[model samples]
Target: MAAAAHDPAGAYDLLVIGGGINGTGIARDAAGRGLRVLLCERGDLAEFTSSSSTKLIHGGLRYLEYYEFRLVREALAERERLLRLAPHIIWPLRFVLPHDEGLRPAWMLRVGLFLYDHLARLRTLPGSRMVRLRTSPVGAPLQARLTRGFLYSDCWVEDSRLVVLNAMDAQARGAEIRTRTGVEAARRQGEGWIATLRDGASGRSETVRATAVVNAAGPWVSETLGGTLGIDSRAAVRLIKGSHIVVPRLYEGEQAYILQQPDTRIIFAIPYERDFTLIGTTDVPYEAEPGPVAISPEETRYLCDCINRSFARRIGPEDVVWSYSGVRPLYDDAAANASAVTRDYVLDVAEADGTRPALSVFGGKITTYRRLAEHAIEKLKPYFPGLAPAWTGDAPLPGGAMPGADFDAFLAALRREAPFLPDETARRLARAYGTNAREILRGARSLADLGEAFDGGLTGAEVDYLVRHEWARTPDDILWRRSKLGLRTGPDSAARLAAHLTRGRAEAA
Candidate 1:
């Protein structure tokens, strides 16, 4: 459950700021290892960076250029572990990277693929292969000149849900996940740190204490360190704004494309939501204040043109139906190019005394979050002599505890059990909730039992479930983050949902 800004037992062992993938992952891992943990987020979980990813859980194919072998190897090893942990929200996706004539040579591409394939023991995802783009259906959408391509395996994740699932698991393990709350200031008092948490909803500040503080604040790492914690991290962040655009499904089929740009950068054109194609992620140096960002006209045009070079069907900024942007807080290694900044994480520790420790997380991608969490906890081992050994690798996150981690088999059985549900609705619920989907549909014999219908299969029952279990408050939390129904559902349905939630709250009051 999402806890209120009230902690009756007083002090905690760990106080985690930022509710992104890294923060929640650390919270889940630390709490499971028997720590009194309290995770406070300034907004809803993944309201920024974590939610705004290309949503690929892969050893970044392009990172090979930068010689990020260790990062790639660690990420490559984690794919199957995460796939097993949350099969509902994560699944294998095949990417077709076509040879663009003047770009990297075929042999170089093969070498990179070979390294990616053997980087780690890939137990679940298949290895890479060369494909004939001219004859295959995957080629139909591409330009004819792109005759040869490399087909490789990666996993796609519901990024926001992954954050939420981690927060949920953390909560289940006795970690207090307090959302819409920010640690205004923290100071080391005696042997521990005393923190003032400001709740956004109530405009109230409460005093809390923790033996250690973990700053996983993604974009606000520096700001949080200097402004809130009054500690100089000495580590800097390179803010690279990444933007994506969604349009009508560009091509038919489940396969996605990784288009190469003349600038040596790459963009992905993936199938998104059922009816739309997701394209994007431009790496631009961000100079402005770091908060919510939008896709600039240049970025939109850049994305369209990148994919246009390969795809036969052309697209433009006007074709964009939805666009989102997030700024990556990469640890600055001072690379000349914005895209060349490392995706690896750097941990800066500040502990004047042995008891009160402040650890700030710098840069990391989603695929390595679990490993990052394990390592973060291990870093604090000196502070907590009794900290339990790491265990997230083999464990399952909440609803993903289905036998064998076989999503297809579990989905088929769900269809048989809930015969009355629409095929699309059933599949959506199964993907979102996994085995726990049945509980939401339990006691309801027919579609009518789902309560008032909203767009994109959202029902009153699901809304109540989200409010009760998922820490959802505003419409945007449910519409955009908890579910992407906002893509298809119009304003009318959103208004109705707003009213329903308001009325429900009033009755409870």
Candidate 2:
């Protein structure tokens, strides 16, 4: 088993940089394949681009315009696989695309939806069907001008929790996961690669050696490769910033809306946190540091305008309760428009003289991250000739072993066991922790045993579970990654949590 403390001089079969979905997925896959793996992250898992996605596990419907047939098909297939494998956290969702003659012609939209439905052999989700806007509940929130729309199936995911779950599974499978540990430098050493990492909190530096290295740092991929390892590859990553705004729920149902903007770009207004609407996404080219990616005033206004144009209710800045931004590290395909950049990922393996190999991932989406990991490990198969064959397709992620993978039934069971807990709390715990919800609420007969209530449904026991098992080091991990309590919890709650964390760390030291 890999040690908890970083041993700079220790050797590893693989050292994966980045703790996002792609990186954590690769580490989990590689470790399961019998490779000694060590994954290092400069920040918390999914703190960057991975957590900021539109939080859909859908096959990119717009990719059809770019003629990315294969990519779309593979992503569509993965959607079903993920829904089955992690039903507790990922489930089916319906999207209503209101007709807009100015953006996309009705015939063209029909063709796209048709192709989307038929692209993958969908067995579980319902196919696309035209709805009468005047009659359907999905159309109630829309303007009266829109008479008809199409409702299609997709899957919604708890994006950040997905990353943490991957890391947890990887750790359970014997892979070491380190958060807030930055790889400061790396270089070729003998027939292997040696790297130095520093803990962000303590500034403690350690050296380690690895037979192979994977650069899956998302937006920092290029910088980590060239600056840390001194290897320059021809493949480049294009950074496109996308933003999302959360406002009070505008509709009562679970159905989401995919609105068509006049500029030919599509924006999604989805149900979030049960009481909020998540409207997002602009595709502007970005060139800033990956951290501190915040939604801009212009982007907020743009999203609000799109929503107001489609729905009868008009929302403004004051209505935006929360906002976030993330950069998509797309493969630089030399496309003139950022929206046209390819969502497909590219793997670059630098093995000069066939001695030391350093693999770097270019671009990938959350929906296709599992496939990306499988492909990445396949690339390293030549080095580890005895590695296990791909198996994640049939494997269930941690906490996803509900019978038939039926989330509703699992929630019913949880509510029966914890009758004293609020219905919402029981459902949230079951969804977030699956069968492990019992472990979190162990020995607790009532809500008071769960300890201090922070925000949303988060409790002290849940926070402690995240810190002990999920590699969560800071309060933000609990607020943002494990749960979106940051939006519901006031700033004062955050400060109190921070103080508690500081005290806990001091006592542990």
Candidate 3:
């Protein structure tokens, strides 16, 4: 897929310049509305900020402290909507917030939880309630000093899968999704916008015309506008780095712990990947060029200290098996610190005398991506008069549709149909693909029918499906993003698999 300079026949109604959650979400919405859409990403979808979330679909309980009632309310409302839309990847989770003496007062927290519970209608999740940590099994892992805790309801998400499902749905609805392609520049051309898109592999540039452009480039939102589009907007983005670490499972059970730090910040210790504890999220200001960032020594220490203090079993940097960091391009509202920056999104539509529209999105969390998409489409509605009404709220994302959106029942049915499949394999496939898993294993009689078996239950059929449909090219795309099978892969197996996939792709070409 080499880029061509002149392709008059390839004109589009909208050119979305990012494949992260917001960009993919917008493309999905626009395409569902019958817009001719093209989305280009310099890397794989959700390769950066979109994938590097706390992986929660929740009303930010901490935002209440900042008086972001509108954001919290909107997110709370969207929580159930997303759960309905993508039940396969989004599930309700209970967070235990222990009331420590030196941190936020117990009554203040009670009031905040009260407000959080009443902010919106929660149909699938439970309301917050105080728990006697002294007697409850949920508190057995925590330090004895944390005798009092409050259990609140939120949702956990497969963050990267959310992005992929959106892009996949967009493509199914007739949107052109180009991964490993970058938009080099865009300019207002007469009544619309013309952009130069470059193929990341071949380094060839192509010219494309679109009715409008959406700059949802995540950490590169500002750079895409000023550096690439040569348009200065009234809005700007502040870079903030958020980091997380995955360690050997520290505690038992499915519940997660939200520990308040000494600096008035909070960190989450969640059960991850069946056998790991995921801890994270430091709000350190970043002042460098944006790319894949790593957890710093100081951040590692900070997170470890937070965990060590809260849990009975102490952990140090030595316990960390994997750590990742991503830079958040927050809307610069002049907050005093990185942690205080608003997670609400701002859509700035820069136009040439109100003719050619270029909308740049800044500062949004994953929890509110669908709403942000509706607003983004609304911002560009002036150019496309025949644009359809918003319908994503009621739409099911790819592989999310099942009777009543009940995952447990669906899993049981899958097990019945594929009785030869191991319990873990069946559960993983059902969780990952929902009804679509059937397409991969359709008529398969046994594990051998799935072709070569890889580490962590990954199969040749699954890899081929990802490469063919999900735009997965490299091993990281399959192992890390499309699935977390990498955690179980040995270096030799991974290198061998990478070479095999590369050769397979080349041979297919």
Candidate 4:
């Protein structure tokens, strides 16, 4: 571990390592609370586990079976809060759960959905309703044999953009945000922490001093603490890998499907990007390094089989258009099965000799990141007596503060302004960039003025905006993280983007 360098002035109030949802959430909250904060990520914002989520701001209805009522209720409440805060990015999504006799009984699911609806007094989203699948459009994609089902509500989010919006909000609130910067080491000084950060692209190092350090590295939490800070953290992080497959839209309606497998785990088939269906999530113990998590053949087969079993149309491995994997840094609870492990997060604050302190976050889900940030900062309130009070419950993230936070109205306004742009492009920009869509279209009057088209609905203007504002560095960062253009563009488009990025890099140099 590196020793603390001598500094005459006091160090920063907090230094957060990692640009994932949790890290950015913490940075935003801390900065909002009048604390001097600095956040650093070794790669692009949400370039790893954060962007690879199922993209639902859900309460995890299945967790009720494991008696995680508190976790479920908290997340359920947050779903509504996020909808109010970022209506452009997070909106209500109804889910259809088709009853299968072989998997779970209908009565049990009814009770689960009942508890889910009432657990948190939902305001904007409607309550759960029993459905006759034979008469409903949600049943069209399923086998004719399925006659009964239930409909419930959750929220969908642009997962990667959520992280970027959080980081942008933090930066707007006086927090120093650094992407492609790795925390080399951190050590306890007399009353603060001295840390070394290295630029990943250029290999340049800069020393920083901070009053406290938060290890919110998501999957890299344990490794960061033990390796970078030399702190023997008591909390253990269980690495469970989850994978998702995207295919052309198989269903017609806006509703998603929650299919119950024989193993008792539920697989989600969500309508994604207008023309694609997103199916996901196999829980397997993972020991691989934290970046570029790849979907294994076993996972691909498992998801395909699960989807095929529920729907009339059979899907196979070859039908998969795109796939992604992410390791959930779950808090270790000694669960025998990886699927049974808890998704709840735990915060451990270590203070040696009643002076220097280091806070380590164990596990968290995308749905509960905002609440987790508030709780994490609450844990450190005593250390910083002058820190402001908690206040992230109702705050708007960047690009989310449009009139009434109403997405439909915002879209109507944008369409009137940019009538020449395709309706699809206008809606996409409004949803992804919110009020900033004007900035992206700055001087463009026609499609030609927007510059080259790299992929479906992707253009040079959007790419430049991402590179300049969203911390997008490489082509993959833009295609995969900033947007899902990779799915629409295919392998060749990546090469074209690479060439464009290379030229931009050379011109800048």
Per-candidate Cα lDDT values, in order, are 0.91, 0.89, 0.91, 0.88
For candidate 2, give the lDDT of residue 36: 82
Where is model 2 more than 4 Å wrong at Cα? 1-9
Clashing pairs in 4: none
Model 1 Cα lDDT, one tens digit per residue, 1-509: 43633357579999999999999999999999999899999999999999999998888989999999999999888887898999999999999999889988999999999999988775567789999999988999998889998999998999999999999989888899989998999999988999999999889999999999999999999999998899976699889999999999999999888888899998999999889999978999988888998888998999989878899999888899999999999999999998899999988889985669999999999999999999999999899987789999998997899889999999999999889989999999999999879878888888899899999889999998888888888899999999899997888999999998898778867
Q: Write the per-residue lDDT of candidate 4 for residues 1-509, one digit (tens) a residue.
A: 11122234536889999999999999999989988888989888898889989999999999999999999999998998898889889998999999997778899999999899889966568889999988888888899878999999999999999999999888778788888899999998767898988988889998889988999998999999899988987789999999999999987989999999888888999999999999988999998777677998989999999998879999999999889888889999999888889989999998887667788999889999999999999999988888788889878887788777789998999898888898988988988888888999987888888877877778888877887777777878887787777777867777888887787778867
Pairs clashing within candidate 1: none
Candidate 2 — what's its lDDT? 0.89
Which has the better TM-score: candidate 2, or candidate 4? 2
Alpha-carbon TM-score of each model against the true structure: 0.98, 0.97, 0.98, 0.96
Q: Please identify which of the two predictions, 1 or 4, would achieve the higher lDDT against the true structure.
A: 1
Specify the poorest-scoring 10-residue window by lDDT in model 4.
1-10
Total clashes for model 3 = 0
Q: Which stretches of candidate 1 lie over 4 Å from their true place?
A: 1-9
Residue-wise lDDT of candidate 2 within 5-57, one digit each (tens)?
43455888899999999999999999888788899998889999989999999
State the lDDT of candidate 3 residue by residue for 170-245, as single tens digits. 8888888999999998898888888998999899998889988999999999889998888987798999999999
**Candidate 1 steric clashes:** 0
